[model samples]
Target: MQIPEFSKEQSALLARFLAEQKDALSLAQTHGYLFAVICAPEPLDVHQWLEQVVPGCDGQMDEQVLFAFMALYQQISEHVFETGYSLPVSLQFNSAQQPYLDMQECQHWSQGFMLGAQGYIAKLLAAPQLASELKEALETAQQSLCFFILDSADIASIANQHGLTEGLLCQQQYEVMNEFAAGFAELIEAVAVNSQLYNDEGWG
Candidate 1:
């Protein structure tokens, strides 16, 4: 069971993410914002963040689970791509691992990694102390997707009151928007294990 290879577009997108990530990782100004937020201590208004991710959601990340996780990654990736250097991503998934991840796996990328890829990102933001302001910004990124669904007023409120959409805040704060990397790593690992199991069982 060979995992499907990267499409040209996806490779391009990955290159873009890597490049931006590299710059962000290096910049004293915009370093590692996405990585931290995703792994921080669960926020009080977790629903607000989740609401911003999944539209028409009156629940938490754990309630609507799959969409929540996918939305978070999609929004973050979209933002990174939307930046002056967008990437060409593909609609490809490792079919062999689908059933495994979709079934055997449960919970968010953080839980899957048994480590907080987002938390690791936060460390990059502060380099010493993970402050409350950074945490607030992290929530903003998490809710970014759901925020798109709302009209300008509501979105503006979050942005105005909490500095949600402020690039300065997002840039200055910590976030783990790169949870996709963590999720993908687990995806490939699961695919490998599944292929082995299938081989052992004499299945394709």
Candidate 2:
């Protein structure tokens, strides 16, 4: 199914706003951050998550920019809640007439996702109801997403630690990206089910 997205003009404006802020996440990173916030097992207050993206969360930011940013978050949250597996946009480039993933943007997005989801992940790890198999899958998914964020030195260290070659890791990049997305979707479903069961018990 086709997904709704911010228009180029809106994106341009957001980018400008991000550029002006000190230590603020880029547009791509903001998208990833918001996605993680939406999929978190427990809901994070909108103001809380907004502070992560912009840092201040008061009346300092321009009204128009803040409005656009909040609108972007709302759209992404609605999409995830409505259609379970929809991913926010990522960068792609044409190389030799074939499309290739933009690793830099992916790195920023992955970093932002981790930053936003760290609290939820810690809770998930300790939750007794989380099955062993699902926990393992979550680990694999986290590793897959981490690949994009790791530097060459770190990648080499990991490869050597695992007794694997850098060439092998490079060859598996695309496959790992697919795995990351699928695993994230699975995580969302699992957490949603857990939340629902918790709510039902509370009501009962």
Write one digit per residue (lDDT tens) for candidate 1, span 1-204.
232332445434433433443222111111122222332232224444334333344652232233333344444444444432121111233665321121111122223222223433333334333345544544444343122234446545656888466433332221232343334323322332333322333322
Q: After superposition, how far is residue 46 of candidate 2 from its true place, in Å?
A: 2.0
Candidate 2 C-alpha lDDT tens digits along 1-204: 343465667788998988788888998788778877777655577678778888875546676676677678777766665654444443354665544556667677778888887776766666677677767767677667656688879878877887887645643664665556645755756754553333433311
Q: Model 1 Cα displacement at 67 (Å)? A: 23
**Candidate that scores best on TM-score:** 2
> Each model's number of backbone clashes?
17, 0
lDDT of the structure predicted as candidate 1: 0.33
TM values, all candidates:
0.21, 0.76
What's the true lDDT of residue 104 in model 2? 63
